[model samples]
Target chain A: MERIEIGHGSGGKLTRDLIEGLFLKYFKSPELHSLQDATYLPGFEKIAMTTDSFVVQPIFFPGGDIGKLSVAGTVNDLTVSGSVPKFISVSFIIEEGFPISDLERIVSSISKTAESAGVKIVTGDTKVVEKGKCDGIYINTTGIGDVKRELSPKFVKPGDVVIVTGFIGDHGISISLSREEFEVETEIKSDCAPLNSLLVPLFDVPGLRFMRDPTRGGLATVLVELSETSGLGVRIYEDRIPVRDEVRFICDMLGYDPLYLANEGKAVVVVDRKDADRTLEILKSHPLGKNSQVIGEVTEEKGVVLVTSVGGMRRLELLEEDPLPRIC
Target chain B: MERIEIGHGSGGKLTRDLIEGLFLKYFKSPELHSLQDATYLPGFEKIAMTTDSFVVQPIFFPGGDIGKLSVAGTVNDLTVSGSVPKFISVSFIIEEGFPISDLERIVSSISKTAESAGVKIVTGDTKVVEKGKCDGIYINTTGIGDVKRELSPKFVKPGDVVIVTGFIGDHGISISLSREEFEVETEIKSDCAPLNSLLVPLFDVPGLRFMRDPTRGGLATVLVELSETSGLGVRIYEDRIPVRDEVRFICDMLGYDPLYLANEGKAVVVVDRKDADRTLEILKSHPLGKNSQVIGEVTEEKGVVLVTSVGGMRRLELLEEDPLPRIC
Candidate 1:
């Protein structure tokens, strides 16, 4: 049974062996082997660059592994930011003694995910630390994309409507249950996915002001940030926010709110009220966004207020503690 | 004294408090606070992007800490790629129960180093894992730079001269001693630094073919890689390679070759023979490169060979294994 050793990250023969044997074998791209310190990309006047480090516990989850989540996380960040996700750099810090077979599986997932999204895994690095110094592996991916439209909260106005692309909390709950720390079981799977194929086309819709994927801290944190940044209050209808029955059941049993659970494949969009219907129509046509709904609207006031299903308006404060840590 | 809890990385209120009180207080970049999922950088037709994950042990090391190394590592990667280092995205994966004061100290160091390099830490992410799941902290930085010139080994020919920017092995020896695992002591200082300001001017030099900072694998690995990539051999004079006496002594005591030790603030430049003298002179004028020297030349043969002080030629192999792990 071959396993990853500390020598694999020594930047010498073993490192080269690992790269050529595993990484290059999976990420076979010209830009990756271009023999330059930095991967060079030509022809882009303006660019959007974002980075995320994936530290999910139970590296292999129900629907996806760390590799898939790593690629999807960075790609979604760029896509939601109004950029056409093009190239990404993936770096891995693996703990020694990790099975090479698992590493290969993860790499294959990264390749498949990137190919499906039409994005290239152009550059990468791998480092192996001693056992106990790190968990199985942590992946940091930074994505660069070509800007297609302007998507900033600055364009979010008081009359704008807020829309959610799909069901939330699946990823958070899936990762949480995978740990088996709570002695619970469910068939729920992570909503981990790349959204460029779904959201990039929406740039043609007029008045599309902002789009962001709810990952850590989930939907509530993003809405709060949007409110603070736009100086406009956000009011969401609790009934309108979509949640799967299984996810809702787990949240209720655990005293966790679905609003604060992470979603790897969901988008919170803000657009002109006149364009909300059109945006929802555009989103619903995609498989990932089949449950698209107008969940809220921007208000003239200055905080996030949620209208509960019981017909009571209450403040949805920021997530104060980590109910599910390392959900990534 | 408050320590960093898992909540700080929950992407919730504690995360916001840490960002506002610590990260924003230090980073203070407009792009960082622009309230966007991905930082937007405007206007660059062609760009170089590089990413490195720093997991140096004993986070605080002699001459430089993880903060300084994180900045310099990515910035130098961009610099050697013939790019003017511009923007960087930093992500941190910290272990829970880590001291907040140490984290702040690291953040402050990052601010100072980024400022000195004229690069912006435009975006960042923080995640905290359970205790013992990771080392104290690991920082990963991805740098984006504007290409100032085309510097690649494809431009190298048989007559190219190899020039090293400064003394080698100081960083490796310093870090090795800092660990104190072997009970060896030395006064060597890590040569970690940002070299764009020092090397950017040399783009004006005629026949500047390629440049690369020798980090993890040291000069031997760089030369070997250059040989394999350019299809040319490299021959270096052992006497001509500059190594500080303290570093050499420690290497000798430990039976390690100075050529294979890591160097944080050094570069191996490949230039046409006609421009070697001029490039060396330009580099030597900078304080960080006062020991700049031309130690080798590209040969028609096809491997990396070192001429020993005893007048025997021997192969300088790629770093076989990490003699000193976490040396950065």
Candidate 2:
């Protein structure tokens, strides 16, 4: 009867009792137990501050895990706004039955990733929940920093050049094939990696019109958002778009679009046509951007189009149905 | 087939795919994707920011919910030392087959709780994972704020008075009976509530030694922590500690001690005797504190001790095990 069970997560009276009786007693603080949506500081600027929790299933997929994804997800949020990545707090909700060896491995990866990106895990907290009550483990990370640069939708012009940091859908396809059973899967590794190193280098360059990581809905979605945000149309050369043969093959077999498959280590940066070559060159030297390319150009047209390999043009549609393997 | 499922929670390829495909693309920024442990921001002070994902079952538990618990858990860490609660970002990992009505209810509760404590939900992200792949639903809330206040261990005083707001053990026992069939069942309500209104009002007061909310490990754990932190012993009166009849009945039947129970709507304030009366008065009038009382005193004895009803003293030992009721 005293044993912990899955029911504790019921959000019922029992949940509260556990929090109030045991957890809260030790974590005591008025602001903490205030139980608000967001903690109130009584002072903040006109800027936006946000935190996100991530629990991606695998610790290491083709591209990422709960750890790296947790970090990348937060960084991308700040990056698009021209804000620099800053300090982060990492908390792990480890199940009692989780493998300690795996955790150590994950932590080492996290440490290495943070070091490469030049951020620090200034503080950390850990909690162990009973098995079945949680997945193997969940990682929640929060980040805060200053937005030193100014980025606006206005900077995106109709004549801008649309450049991608590297190949699209590698991370998604790699992960999908790795996690699930599939035929015609390729030997592609995930494109999961950090982009801040490239981001800082790019900020010093001119004509950096717009930047976004094509993560979830992939290139199409990101392009759609930018077009909507910038009130501009976009056209792309399908032949020039970067996609590993493995990724393309898998997407074709599964009826998934590489354009919509996620990429952890890639990004879409819009720069002026004049600066595209320079930008591409700089990105190429970075390991994550070695496959960088100029896929398309921004336009004043009202819709998005892709030039087919046969020289025909087609409209790139918005995502309507869930492409489950899109994450790969 | 596109629905997010339990397998996606496996921390494998699909999880990576999900983030890269959906989450990363839309949330992309130049500063993100370094896949690091912590992000570095040069200007502001280094902050350890974090977000938590919770899917506690049985929404209307004896104490709180995934919503309230999410907020409390994050804020507690921020309030653990240098900072006050400032801003938070929330994300929802919802189960597709779960009840939308319940979701709405949880949202409303979260909003109300946040508003009451003056915190804003400012920004949030939502995603639908498949049924069973997730518990009913999971919530990820992240918070950030300034760490201007100095509540370090050095602030602890040897002769401080330990004031507990209202009762203990009720929250845990209530949840136990409500969530599961226990050996000795009793109907007891949880003390889950926000305590900032009471505590903030006392911030400007003098001789305010220290404060904590006895949550997971309850009063016993918190006192033990204080003893270690301040290098001072604590002496608490058994009679002075508050306990409700229902909680006592259930604990007695289960061979549980009320002192170690969790509390949401409670706090332990360490202050000098001079500020004790003023502190109690302020706490008594608050909605969360109808039965505030002085339960113990700090001592030079260097550990945790309880003055028993038989006029004999006993040491409060550390907890060796966890009381878990979890929802993945």
Candidate 3:
């Protein structure tokens, strides 16, 4: 009805009209129209839903694009819950004058990702803003899955050993290196791989406490969440945490902590000490989890502490600030 | 890490990074990481999952914003499935420099909508792009619910009477009129409201068939889809379809049909003729469906046909081109 500009995306009355008039028009599914925080699904013994947004600069990075990440990230969220990731709804916001080629590529990537995950892209959306309004692209993917196993966000507790699926901070570091405009002799790669394959074995274990992928804010944030959820503390030794040499070097040069950087294809698992050894063994056997390590143990205290390499103790706070803006 | 340009949202490699890095980081629910299409959720029972996107220009229209629409649209989708709305996930892609006030309004709207629908925004994501990349804001919301009563996409059949929930084309007409360039006064108001409250009475009917909302591509697209999915055709009398006088005048003036124009808060129901009268009665009582009307009948054919006001017949083809480009 009007020439769209960046202002339209603002949460003003016109924005509302666009959603009501255009979005709701094509996607008439009832669950979405309620405009609720979470769609209450009554029939399942367990339910899984996930939300994710892409703010990657360049839209496509060295290894993957926002489209792939949007789907993968959402599916993994559901997968770790031991739910079968079933449906995903994608939303895309495009700036005007964007090349159609890129849209096709992204859609193709989404199709490929969906096929790989054995899911269907039943419905999706696209919106366009005028030129000079926003960045290149941003993607939001919400996923739904049905709980297939007896899993609970309730099992994590103190004294459980923490296991990381693979090497840490590759994703964040790779992006940083590319963005820093610094010359590096060593080649670095992002660990943006799928985790469903790795989860297959972990689900076979009966006493697995909890599992979460460490993306933005990395292992620190997830461990803190685990502790807060379980009302427990966590203690991790700096020496034991795995870090790729390239990531470590970049962090050193950038004065960053690999611990706090994001990792695309990694997970941090908290399990009963009895199940700890088996979990690590299981993770190490998988390609995605090749650098698997025992990063920490749940603590009885209410505060999260990091046992340093110098034997000094300090707290690992929730990443107080975005270490690298839009690294995801 | 490069200053995001419009090319990134083009759906290429850059889009993938934005997704993998940012989305997976904050939202990191396992199912999300799988990068799937339709998530392979567990159980094939009566579950409803709906997807909608908000690309409203001038977000925060007269009555609502994209946030409200994000939640409302999803809720309506589930309601159409004869399910009580439950949970919703929200995702946002915002351009840099957008005012925070508008976002608060939109988010507040979401909270309000969720509360009203008795659903939760269990998960959400946000992304900020540089200027010149996106409009102000765009939202994608996905809603899921458990169907209490038996419902399926194949519920429509021959001998079923088509019932519309309310006046048609109000949303399209209102939005068009509301646009900045449109310089005419019109009493037409967008029909943007949740329909879950109206559905309770009709869902349990002895022979209620399929149900859907005619949003985008309007009534014609919805009826065509109904025909295809139900393996049945439909014949509608133009004179019987409900349209506010002002809306019809606006459409006529603009060379648009109420059938092809969008309706925000509306639905098309195919119910047993035995229950058609009762369905109309129930719909008429609900505030959201007060103008409910019987519009057509399902048939054994495979496509939709519209009987003109003068008794001539014309095939109502599904929309093949983007009418009202970027209308959403």
Top-TM-score structure, candidate number: 1
| CA lDDT of every candidate | 0.90, 0.64, 0.69
Each model's TM-score, in the order given?
0.98, 0.82, 0.81
Candidate order, DockQ descending: 1, 3, 2
The segments of candidate 1 whose C-alpha lies over 4 angstroms from its true place after superposition are: A181-185, B181-185
Candidate 3 CAPRI assessment class = incorrect
Residue B11, model 1, lDDT: 88
lDDT of 3 by residue, A1-328 (tens): 4334343343233444555665555444454454322333435555567777777765676777777777778777777777777666777776665665576567667767766776555455555566665565667777777666545436767678888887788888777766757767656777776577787568878778677778766788777656665678889998898887778877888899887887778877777899878888888887777788887888788767889999999887665456676765
List runs of model 3 lying over 4 Å from the truth. Answer: A1-44, A82-86, A94-101, A111-123, A128-136, A148-156, A178-182, A204-207, B1-45, B148-159, B181-183, B228-232, B299-303, B310-314
| Model 2 ranges off by over 4 Å | A1-50, A62-65, A123-134, A181-187, A325-328, B1-55, B75-83, B181-187
CAPRI quality band, candidate 1: high
State which docking tier applies to candidate 2: incorrect
TM-score of candidate 1 to 2 decimals: 0.98
lDDT tens per residue, model 1, A139-239: 99999999889788889899899999988899998988888767566789999999998899899988999999999988998999898888889999999
Q: What is the Cα-based lDDT of residue A238 in candidate 3?
A: 88
